[model samples]
Target: MTPLTVEVTSSTGSDHLLPSKDPWYTAPADFEASIPGTVLRIRTVPGQPTVFSNAAAAYHILYRTTGSRYQPTWAVTSLVIPKKPCVHSGYNALLSYQMAYNTPTIDRGPSYRIFEPPLPNNYGIPPGHQQFDIMLDRGWFVTIPDFEGPRAAFGASVQAGHATLDGIRAVLSLAGHPDIPLPSSADKFKYAMWGYSGGSIASEKAAELQVQYAPELARGFVGAALGGLVSNVGSLYTVTNKTPYMGNLVLILLGVMNEYPEVDTYLRSRLKTEGPQNATAFLKGRDMDSFQAFQTYAGQDIFEYFVGGEADLEACQALRKIKMVEWMLGYHGAPEVPLFVYKAIEDELTPIADTDAHMEHYKRFNVSVLYERNTVGGHISEIVNGQDRAIKWLASVFDSSYDKEGGIKTRDVTVDIYKPPIP
Candidate 1:
């Protein structure tokens, strides 16, 4: 097959691009690669929606490359916008598209995948599965924003969110072009956000910034679902001590701190001399094997290097004080749109209590709520199957259920005849 390439354009006319071949993972047999205008594109035809009448449209895959500063440099691929008839009118309405991160070879890093595609047929490496596919099945466009930017932007959740939201805008801008079809006369946009794990970080940051960063988007966003949320960095470190979850957490911390000085400073003070080297090694590798290496080399306990011995706890706290306040645990206001949160009761990776504290603030607001606690899945599993419930609930969000009192009326769990676990 001819190697596909997408020329990602900047706000200006300049371009830097990404090749369309799977950087790491194998492309399914049906993957169609096309370069639309300046953007490199891959698409799957719109299929029937299981619930709604609108044909579920898939990606008009798009990508952008940003330098280390995370500035937009070029449009690497054509924005792949999904198409389906609008619910309000028979005419086609433009929904958003998402790009997968950490999937390609050049984009891969030591500790992290650097947002490339999964290794071909490596079933153990998670990310591309149910929720991501289910969103496409339900008619929402999916763009896995390789948020690592052109340089493999990693740990830059806010930056990732911006690209994802902007990608949607780009798709809408293309909907009216002669080549694209409009399903009906009244096809305006309706959007909802969903992601788990690292993707959740991007989605949540986007939600916080929607009103301030992109008010135009704020009006169009119907709701968002965030699963396996990681709120406080310090709290996460504590959770990873004995649990295997520490590996990814370590890589994410190193990835972000290396790019951002404030975080780097925190790591330097907290970690022993070897901590920095360990971090670098971790970032270079993309899978669990590297995680085990970091764990083994650093000794059985990882917390002392992070939080410090009980004797040195005060010093660690002082160093944390010097770090950026917003980066630590910033205040994100109540979401203007409804929120759907799924958390695992036995999640070994992220602390559920931290999520609880954040939700407490949202509950006080007038926003509606649908909460589920799962018993079977871990972080990655919850992200995949959680969608089985989240998407259906999201469909109901479009339906009339909000009470006159501004609270969401109780709807069935939509899962089964049994109760959902509560953390």
Candidate 2:
């Protein structure tokens, strides 16, 4: 069989030469660990452009996870174990950090991003690399999962949640392994989750799905801090459609097309030459920057590009569930774990009103939530503004005997409106 080549601003590395059309990410597997979140393969040897090779014994894991429909799927995660000891109780703390790469490209996840110099250019280093280094500097063990799944289902929360939880599961399951030197009592490690902006989607979804889908895995998690929460996907589509940022429509469409066959058939049936052209652009350039994706389909609306009248499209009706109640958070119910949700009131991408509604919805569940609505920043600005405070909160959560905060917390979800100091 001849190796297929994909075109983009791509380098001639990555062991597999993938096809232009959906490049299949697969490895020869024995499925030795045959559980829901099991490790199929582990790479002890480090890759090029290592991040923390000096202080941490780094490795990557190819783990088995579930898709949106609970189908057997696979994901990759990078695990870093610190050589030094922990700060407080001498037990190494674990943090599952989800970075919001946003694009539906598997090759550009944290497994590729945190490595060397040139790779981060495309794979996207986390906006909170400084914070990550601070955690790493504290001798913390961190697992960065390719939460978008192998096919890169960017906005698929179910897929993201499973991948996030399963990634941590795979790492913890590695305890007592001869080669990987994890703590003898790995369960003692206090687990906390955090993400900002696009990543906040994955982080929050993981929190929401924890008690139900992964009860055992959820037991270890102390708290989740998420900001720039995407409470309503419908508003996102409505706001971006036909506008200059119409590329977001293309991004979401391309992502859903991979996850939902109905979406693919529905969307493709409507488009003429330009429709497939834009979709193809999304597939080939999965590594597209948000702005680049926007520019590709800029100023064009999906309905406007439809071959017939918008009412004639039945696929739009099927896709209706995704934008509104189905995939969106709060509508599903509240997470059992403690939550730190911060959002900028001036956010342009995800409106604060929807976040308010999401917070209120969670409040009904009696979850102990620390809600901070910043008055001073927009989407990008709020990243820096809300991050430090979130880190501070995580420190407090892990410090004392307060690791386990039971029940849908009864107390009022603390809400604060403050002005973030300008950077």
Candidate 3:
């Protein structure tokens, strides 16, 4: 196969343009003709000094990928190559670390936030940058793809899956390239994926879809580590409706609307147009970050934004479209690789029962899984508490020491640091 040609763009200063303002993000006219994963553009970028102090270089790649409707589109992935040699014995290691940038805003992706001088309003560094630093410190290359795709379709699982896989493809294709700085042995890299919360949506979908959508790359994968898995999209309405996380409904609706036209029409027709907190005004206003969503819509009921209230929002035909495998987990297929799955029993956003059912579904298909149900902490706290174990599991896989013969295994544990005084 001929190596894909790369167009290198300059990035010399602190002023980094958002995807919307940068021409480098725009897909070329002939991009549709190229195969998925074809690298269309490349640019050298500054990695977060605090996060990538051990890294040799960082670059962003604009690559061809399929969108939510299976239409040809493009996505960007940020790659960080470490200065040290491989920590895993024989092969190079690559970890696709998906960030939980749960928002409808395209500009808030990791590719933009991974640089110095974090985005305004405490967007700070991307959610998993510290974890990326840990991976880099271990001498593993990390690819942070904007798996939500060009539309920033946050809940569109299929699009996220495609973008995640293609981002890996793009990275592997750039191996040994003089300008890109990838190690020559990148082709032999053992790949693993790690994600939590919204990030888990992409990692889980990519693991399931790899056998069908990108079968050629299946054998290269060691396994995937998913935490805080959202097993069913339909459950979100009941779980998050009037809670502090109620804003998730707005984000999911806006995101899915970008991918499904029917959903857009359905939501627009029903959205209240007169009030300060009306759905129409909120959706049409400035690009929204997840922080803004949480602050603005916290404790508000999502049903109130519609015409007939909860009944209308629930009865809409468009709801059925998103309930498919593309949005719902475990409906499409089982993961082909061994999985290290963990979740908090008290997860406020996603129901533990849904994850329980999801595990049962995968086990029935004979997929190798090591599931851990943490007795303490909720969705947010689990990210910090469960990460040490998750990373250890990933290390075992990359080093070819993980036991694939071990079938489904489940464990219940407590991961909280807080303890009550002796009774």
Candidate with maximal lDDT: 3
lDDT of 1: 0.46
TM-score (C-alpha) between model 1 and the true structure: 0.65
Candidates' RMSD to native: 9.1, 6.7, 3.2
**Positional deviation of 224 in candidate 2, in angstroms?**
0.3
On residues 1-423, what C-alpha lDDT tens digit does candidate 3 reach at each position? 334456566677656788888777788787899999888888887423444677888888889999878999999999888878485566888999998888787888889877654444332223555677788889888899999888889889999999999999889888877676666755578899999988899999999889988898876799999999888877888988888777777888888888888888987888888776686555842377667787778888888888788887668776776777566788779888999999999988899999998898887889999999999988877887788989999999998888986468999998885323333
- What's the candidate order when arranged by decreasing TM-score? 3, 2, 1
Clashing pairs in 2: none
* Candidate 3, position 422, lDDT: 38
lDDT for position 23 in model 1: 42
Quote the RMSD, in angstroms, for model 1: 9.1
Tens digits of lDDT, candidate 1, 366-392: 655565667665654565556567667
What are the per-residue Cα lDDT tens digits for candidate 2 across 90-180? 5457889898776766655677656644323221223445666677776778888888787788777788888898888877777666666
Which candidate gets the maximum TM-score versus the true structure? 3
TM-score of each: 0.65, 0.82, 0.93
Name the regions of candidate 3 deviating beyond 4 angstroms: 1-4, 46-51, 117-127, 284-286, 418-423
